[model samples]
Target chain A: MLLIPCPYCGLRDESEFVYGGPARALPDMDAQTPEAQHSLYRPINPRGPLRELWYHSGGCECWITLTRNTITHEFEDDLS
Target chain B: MGYSALSLMGHAFRGNTQWPTLIAAPDMRTIYDIVIIGGGGHGLATAHYLAKIYGLTNIAVCEAGWIGGGNTARNTTIVRSDYLLNGSFALKHFALKLWEDLTQDLDFNIMYEPRGYIDLAHSDGELEQFELRANAMRLRGADAQILDRSALKARIPLLSLDMDKRFPVSGALFQPAGGVVRHDAVAWGFARKASQAGIHIFQNCPVTGFDISDGVLQGVQTAKGHITCKQALISVAGESSAVAGLAGINLPLNSINVQACVTEPVKPALDAVVNYNVGLSYLSQTAKGEFVLGGATDGYASFARRGSFERIEDVLARAVQMFPFLSRLRLMRHWSGTADITADGNAIVGQTPVSGLMINSGWGYAGFKATPAVGHQLAELLATGILPDLIAPFALDRFALGAEQDDAGIGPYPWLH
Candidate 1:
C-alpha cells in the first residue's frame, strides 16, 4: 500500500488520502501585478521537488498541501 | 440511434455477432462505412445521431441478438440528470431533457413519468453531502432541491422518520428531472428511426473478427460474410473488453456483473427513488407497481455474468430496511447484466489507440440515462474524426495524460464507485 504524508491530516496511509498528484500553485489574491504574479503561478511539470495536494477524505476532512520529492515520496513539510 | 434488441426481435433470445455468421447473409450488397456492434440503446442511439444529426448514413448496426437484449432491457430504469460534477452537464441534462421529450419525439409511449428522484440522508454528514450535491446541481442549471427532514417527511409520509427506527430516512435531495421510463420503448423508437434513416440493422450477425490492416480498420469478418468498413464503434457495455480484444485493441475495462431484481406487484408506495451511498442500493417502483431494485456488486471483476441468490436476498433486505412493507412483497424476478467497470466509474468515449476504432463503453451502470448525450457526442466524433470536448476526458489516454477526473463526488453507487 502507498503511504502518503498529508499536509493537513499529517502522515497517513495512502488509502486515507485521495491521490491528488502535484499541487497546482494558485496566485495570491492580492498580487501586485497580474503578469508578474502569474510567473510564480505558472504550472510546473517538474521532475524534482513537487508540491502535491491531497484530500484527507478517509481520515480528516481537509485538503492537504505538501512539497515532496516526486521520485522518493520524501516530503519536506506537511501543511494540513 | 435507437437500438432495442427487445423490440427488434420481439424480445427473443439474444444472438452473437460472431465473425463467421456475418459473411453468409444473402443481403451482402450493402457495405457500410461504419459498423457498430451491439444493437442496444447505445448502438441505436449512435445510429440515430449518425444519420439524423450528422447526416452520415453509411452506418451498420450488426447485432447477434435483438436490440436492447443487453443491459438496455435489464437496467433499473431510473433516469436522473442531477450530478455532483460540472463535466456531466451535457449527458445528464441533455439525456434528461430527451427523456422528458422522448414520448413526443418518438410518437411512442415510453411511459416516462416525471415523478423525480430523491437521495435519502440518514446522518448529518449525509445531509451536508446531499446539500452540496443539490447545490452543485443547482449551480449547473439543473432543477434540484434539498429537502429537510420535515419537508421530506411531508413529501413521503410513509418514510421512516423516527430517530430510533432502522435506517431512518431523515432528509432527501429531490431532483425533479429524475424519473423512470419504459426502457424497451427507448430501444424501439431508436431502432425504428434508425431503420428509416437507411441504417442496416443486421440481426443474428456477430462481429467476431475485425479486419485491421496497417493498424487501421479494413472491415469486419462475421460468420455469414465480411463487411468492409472504414470505421467501427464498439458500444457493447458488458462485452466491451472482448470486443476490443477481437480488434487487437486494448481497453481499460474491468468487467463485472451487476444485478437488479424486481418485487411482486403492489400499489405504488414510493413516489420517487430513494438510495444511500453506504449500501449502494437503489429501489424504485415501476409503473406496473413492481419494485425494481439494484444492489451492490456481489463479486469482483470476472467474465461470468450470473446472478446469485445471495445478492437477490441482499437487495431485498436493503429494500425491506428502507420500507419494511416490502418484506411482504415476493421477489418476482431478478436479472444480472455486465458492467464494463472503469477505474473512475465513468465511460471511456472517443478515439482509442486504434486508428479507426472509437469506444463508448465503460459506462459502469449509468448508460441508460446518458444514452442520448453519449450518442450525440460519439456520432459527432465519428463524423468529424475528432473527440468532442464533452466526453474527451473519458478517454483511456487521460490516465497517461495525468488529467484524469479521479474525483466524481457521488459517494459509492454500484460497481467501481
Candidate 2:
C-alpha cells in the first residue's frame, strides 16, 4: 500500500486519497491548437520521476503535489 | 532430432542425452537486411514470419534478457476476440485463427486450448453494452453471444448468481472460441523455428542507441557491438518510449505495472475463463489446476515490474466476492509486468517520422493475444513498405489527426485505458 503524505494532513493510506493523474499545467483554452489540446488531454506517460496531484478525499479533502519516481515508487512530499 | 514417439523411445534407450537444442546461439553479424528489437513473443514471432513467409533470412532479434523473460512469460494468457472496436477485433480474431494452427505450423507444442471465455455483467446497462459488443464481434466473423443468468449458471456451476446479493451476476458475454495458451511456449516455439530458419537469436544484448543520419536510420548500437541494418523494427512493449528516444522520437506511450497472481494447485473446478468486468478482475484455471488471476493496471503510472499491495487486495476482494470458494486457496505467487499503454486504448503500429524505422508497441495488457497477428502484419509492412489495411487504423499519425481509437471510452488516459 502507498503511504501518501498529504500536505494538509499527515501520512495516510493510499485508499484514503484519490489519484489525480500527472500534475500538468493547463494550456490556454482560448488558443486551442492541436498541440495545446493534446497537452490538456493526453499524457506523455513518463517512465522516470513524475510530478502528480493527489486529492486527500478521505480526510482533509485538499489537493497536494507529489514528486515521485514512476519506476521506483519513491516519493518526496512537496508542501510548497 | 525431431520430437516423435520414435525419437523419445531412442532417447529413453540412450539415457535421454541426445536431445537437440531448442534454439541456436549465434554471434551477431555486422549487418543484416532487417533488425528486430526485443526477443519476446512478438519479436520472435515477427522473425519467424519474416523468415518463413517473407523469405527474409538476414534478420536478427536482439533482446535485453533471455527469450520470454518479459511480459510474454508474465501475462495471464487469456485469448479472446470479443472487442467492440474494428481494428482490435480484426487483429485479435486473425491472431486466434493463427493460434489455431500455431503448433502445427511451428512444429512445437504451444498448449493452445479453446475451452471458452465468459465476461460477467453486473447491471442492465452493462449487459446492453455486452450485447452491443457481441453484435460488433459477430459482424467481424468472431464468435460471441449473450448468455442469460440461468445459462451462465449452467455453464459454470460454481459462479455465484444470487440475484439478492450485492453485485449480482445478471448475465455474461460468452465467446465459445476464446481460450488460453502456454505463454512461454509461444515464445520458445517461435524462437526455435526462427532459429532453425537461420535467424540470429541474440540474448542478453540490449540496444543502447540508434545510428541515424539526416532523418534516416542506419543501424543500432548494442552492448555487444554496433550492427548495421537496412531497416529496424522496434517491438519493445514497455520500453517503447525509452528505445524510441534513442532515435530522437517521442511516442504517446506510458509504461505502467499490471499484476497477476496464481493460487496453489487444486482440483480442476473451473473450465471456462471468468472475467468480472465491473471489478476488472479475470480468473482461469490453468492446465496445472492452479487458478491464474489478473486485475486492473495500477492507477499511477509506473515502469516498475511490480504491483502495489492495495491493488492486490482489491483483486482479492473481488475474486472472493465472485467465487466464494477461492477465499480458502492461498496465493502461491504474485508478479507484475510493465505494459506500454497508449492514450487511445489501442496499439500503435507502423512507421514513425524517421525513415526506415517502424514500431509495433503500446499494446498495454492486450499484446499476448495479438502476438501472431502483430508478427504477420509487421512482416508485411517491413517487406512491402506499405501499411496493410488490417493495421492502418493503428498508425502513429492517428493521434495527431484526432482519429484516436478509444474503444474503452476512457479517453486519453493511459492508466485508465
Candidate 3:
C-alpha cells in the first residue's frame, strides 16, 4: 500500500485518496484544436520520476501535487 | 518424439529417461528476416504462424526473461467472446475458433476447458443492462443466455441465493462457450512449434534500443549483440510504451498492476467461472480444485508487479459474499502483472510512424484471450505490409480520427478500464 502524504492531511493510505494521473499543464479550456485532443488523450506517462496529481478524497478533500517515482511508488519530500 | 499414448507408454516403461527435450537451444544469428522484441505468447505465436502459414523460416524471438514468465503465466486464463461491440466479438470469436483446434494444431496439450462463464447481477437495473448486452452478443453470432434467479441457483448449487443478503441473487448472463486454459502451456506450446520450424528463441536477451535512420528498415540493439532484421514487432505487453520509446515512437499507453490470487486446494466446489459483477470480482476452480480469484486493476498507474491490500480485501469480501463458505479457506498465492492499458480499453495493432516498426499491444489485462488472433493478424501484417481488415479498427490513428473502440464506454481514463 502507498502512504501518500497530502499537504493538508499529512499522511494517508492510498485507498483514502483518488488518483488524478500525471500532472501536466491542461490545454486552454475553450481551445478547439488537435492539440487539445492530444493533451486529453496522450498523457505524459513515464517509467521514471514524474509529478502527479492526487485527491485526498477520504480526508481533507484537497487536490495535491507531488513528485513520485512511477516504478518505485515513492513520494519525494518536496510538494508543490 | 510426438506426444501420444505410445510415446507415454514407452517413456513409462523406460523409466522416463528416453523423453527428448521439448525444444532445443539453437545458435542465434547476427541477422534475421524479422525479430520479435518480446518472447511472450503473442510474440512466439507470431513467429510460429510466420513460419507455419507464411513459410518464413528466418525469425528470432528475443526475451528479456525466460519464456512464459510474464503475464502469460499470471492471468486467470478465462477466454470469452461475448462482447457488446462488433469488432471485439469478431476478433475474439476468431481466436476462440483457433483455440478449438490449438492442441491438435501444435501437438501440445493446452487443457482448454469449455466450462462456461456466468456473470451475476445483483439488481434489476444491472440485470436489464446484461439483457441488452446479451441481445447484442446474440446478434453477433455468440451464445448468451439470460438466467433468472432460479436458473442461477440450479446452475451453481453452492451460491447463496437468499434475498436478505447484502448482494442478493438477482440473475445472471451465461455464456456456455467461455472457459479457462492452462496459461503456461500456451507459451511453451507456441515456442516448441516455432522452434521446430527453425525459428531462433533467445532467453535473457533484452533489446536496449532500436537502429532507425531515414525513417526506414534497420535493426535492433540488444544486450547480447546488435541484431539486424527486415522488420520488428513490438508485442511487449506491460513495457509497450517503454520499449516503443526506444524507437522514438510514443504509444498512448499507461501501465498498471493487476493482481490475482488463488486459494488453498479444496474439494471441487465451483463448476464454472463466476463473475460477481456488482463487485467486479470473478473466480473459477482449477482442475486441481484450487479456486482462482481476480478483480479489477489496482486503480493507479505503476510498473511494480504487485498490488495494494485494500483491493485484495475488497475482492475477498465479495467472493465470500457470493460463496458464503469461502471464509474458511486460506489464500495460497497472490501476485500482480503490469497491464498496458490504452485510453480506449481496446488493443492497438498495426503500423506505427516508423516504416519497419509495428506494434501489437495495449492489451491491458485481457491479452491472453486474443493471443492467436493477434499472432495471425500480426504475421500477415509483417509478411504483406497490410493490416488485416479484422484488426484495422484497432489502428493508432483511430484516436485522431475519433474512432476509438471504447467498449467500456469510459472516456480517456486508462486506470478506470
Model 1, runs deviating above 4 Å: A1-80, B1-26, B407-416
lDDT of 2 by residue, B70-103 (tens): 9999999989888888887888899999999999
**iRMS, model 3 (angstroms):** 1.2
Q: Candidate 2 chain B — worst ten consecutive residues by lDDT sum?
A: B1-10
Instruction: Please provide, for model 1 over B255-359, each residue's C-alpha lDDT reduced to its tens digit, 9 standing for 90 to 100.
Output: 666888888888878888877545667888887889889977644343445644666766777666667788787878877777776656677788877788888
Tell me the tens digit of each residue's lDDT in model 3 across B1-417: 568998899889999998787666887889999999898889988999999899997998889998889999999999888777888888888888888889999999998998989999899998998899899988888889999988998999999888888778799999998999899999999999998889988889899999998987699998888888879999999999989999988888889989999999999998899999765889999999999999999878888898889889989999998998999999999999999999998899999998989999999999998888889989999999888988998999888888989887988888888
The CA lDDT at B9 in model 3 is 92
Question: Which candidate's DockQ is highest?
Answer: 3
* Alpha carbon lDDT at B178, candidate 1: 87
Give residue B237's lDDT in candidate 2 (0 to 100): 90
CA deviation > 4 Å runs, candidate 3: A78-80
For model 2, what is the C-alpha lDDT against the true structure?
0.89
Model 1 DockQ reads 0.02
In the order shown, the candidates' DockQ scores are 0.02, 0.62, 0.71
Best of the two (1, 2) by TM-score: 2
Could you list the CA RMSD of all candidates, in the order they appear?
Answer: 10.9, 1.5, 1.5
- Worst lDDT 10-window in candidate 1 chain B: B17-26
Tell me the tens digit of each residue's lDDT in model 1 across A1-80.
23567645556765565545445455667765655334332323332466666678898778877675533446677444
